[model samples]
Target: MGTLEGRLKGKVALITGAARGQGAAAARRFAAEGAKVMIADVNDAEGKALAGELGDPAAYAHLDVAEEDDWAQAVDRTVAEFGTLNVLVNNAGVLHFSPLGQTTLADYERVIRINQVGAFLGMRSVVEPMSTAGGGSIVNVSSVEGLAGMPFLVAYTASKFAIRGMTKVAALELGERGIRVNSLHPGMIDTQMVSDAAGGAEVDFSRVARRLALQRVGRPEEIADVALFLASDESSYCTGGEFVADGGATATHALKL
Candidate 1:
């Protein structure tokens, strides 16, 4: 649907959390690259709307990434609707900010359920179909927090770190099957999740950006571009790698010179 030439021609991609944010951005980019995309999310209204906007090459499938049955059904629906599963973008996640002591066990588990377990299920659910389709790519959206630690985001950091580890393990195991698994680490992206983590307060992004090499907050579309490369043959030799889209936030430590 875009003016750009096809980079993902004839491929079928399933993107979780595709109702909005980075997930939606990836869906649009993938479709533009000539890939049939399944927008899977619990937000039925937005998901359906996006699918409609993408027209014939896109469809919506209701999915709760935390639910195994939901993941199973979503994958089945994707393969049925698109005829094969070639790419997966596990972009659904929740952010919770709380100090280690203040973070409840329930809160930690909830974050893990969606961010960590959700990706595990997604990768597991698609292996057979993707293998059958002659191998595919799986991009797990982790965070800059995954590579390092940050105060007050105890649970979120843990889940993201888990995703990073899982991606490497999956890549090692699925490499021979032609499945490439990679983790994406983003920093200070302007999204609803960041807003929610700030308790709906206006974020002074400029202040956060000043500390990074790029000196700006990242856009969802920027991350989507990286996802596009991972999903396409452009990254054919890449697997079990960490793609950091942060504004160089992780390049330095606390002792700011």
Candidate 2:
């Protein structure tokens, strides 16, 4: 695509959890597509390194998404560097896998605080700036687990579901202000988080592929592409909606006779 045709050109975006995984992938893609992005994460070393690699000022921040104060500072920093903020990608999250009985309160709180509350604070912090800028987009990174309950991962699943709900509510409340809010649901993907959650458990990747119509685990870029769509003017009319990029995992029938 021509540079002007780059859907995100001239947009200033802030993405949390950007040190690695899906967040980092989205940061790279956003920069490539012509958006000046603020890569926010608690991992200062990695975050700053990524910013250096992006080779731009205003490209990194030490943002702990679960902390409301950190969110405020990140927003301010982005505006101070980029001149304006047009997109907020609530991508920072934590995953703790355990059965309901085994899940600890501490783990649950950490997951929900980062995954759900972080998104909440991110929208709250950026909405005013976005409205003043004439409009903006907020993309919350949800999960397929939000759509269906899994055997393990009670805390992780809970947080994702909460995000999905909050995304819809925020969308409705922010739409009149010209700000759009939406959630992106990703299914099983090849990432360090997933591998860590798997924890050496014997699982068949091919089996997972066969379960989904696409017959494959998704890539970070696959989900990032959806975020890009929701963050840009291309999806100008979309808001308060759930974008399921789960490779048809949710569409399959439960009963396979």
Candidate 3:
């Protein structure tokens, strides 16, 4: 449905957290665009089911982004199955909400380990294989939280900020190798992550929308549209920069106004 649809014809991709949410949406979109996709996630049942639904035997792997060995093996398996690796979407992440005072070391550690370290490992693990396969693109799913602070999500915010910082450095370091690395700063989209962060709090979607220049929370597919562009050659000249797909959430000081 996007302009970049099918631009990745015959390319292969390995997407983490591909069982659901943004990851699942990206996987389906990538495959629809003619990329042989491997949906990797810790959720065995859902991951396997998604693979079946994609109807590609070699298109899924049980991956826990937190584990180094698992990350390496997933890339290996993907190469074995698909014969190449052209894209890596580091989409596996968890959102934990808590005020600074309520945030424990364990909670903070878990958040960073999954959200930040996971992407690092994914990039590191894929470098050699991707290099051998003649370079590739790495798309990291960061958050608008990385651009600004949100109350009660100290750990999540910190982790995403770290991802934003790391992504730039990774892009610079990998560019010479013919690989392009970019991070996506997604605005609050409709997904379970937002639901959990909202946590039954009294809120107004209308007010939230009015604050945005676009005046609305975006859909998962809307974010996927940007992902598709980044994944395909349409964005060939882009790297080491963030694509903010937020619905004008960061466009102005509307919240303060």
Model-by-model lDDT, in order? 0.94, 0.88, 0.86
Model 1 poorest 10 in a row by lDDT: 1-10
84-185 in candidate 2: lDDT tens per residue? 999999998877778899888888898888888888999999988999899999999999888888877888888899899998899889999999999999
TM-scores for candidates 1 onward, in order: 0.97, 0.94, 0.93
lDDT of 1 by residue, 1-257 (tens): 34458999999999999999999999999998999999999999999999999999999999999999999999999998989999999999999988888889999999999999999999999999999999999999999999999999898899999999999999999999999999999999999878878899987898888899998999999999999999999899999999999989998999976
| lDDT per residue (tens digit) for residues 109-191 in model 3 | 99899998998999999899989988889999999998898888888888889888888998889898889999899987877
Which rank order by TM-score, best down to worst?
Answer: 1, 2, 3
Residue 147 lDDT, candidate 2, scale 0-100: 85
lDDT of 2 at 88: 94
State candidate 2's TM-score.
Answer: 0.94
Off by over 4 Å in 3: 3-5, 197-204
> Of the pair 1 and 2, which is ahead by lDDT?
1
Top-scoring candidate (lDDT): 1
What are the RMSDs of all candidates, in order? 1.3, 1.9, 2.0
Q: Report the candidate with higher TM-score, 1 versus 2.
A: 1
Model 1, residue 241: distance off in Å is 0.5
TM-score of 3: 0.93
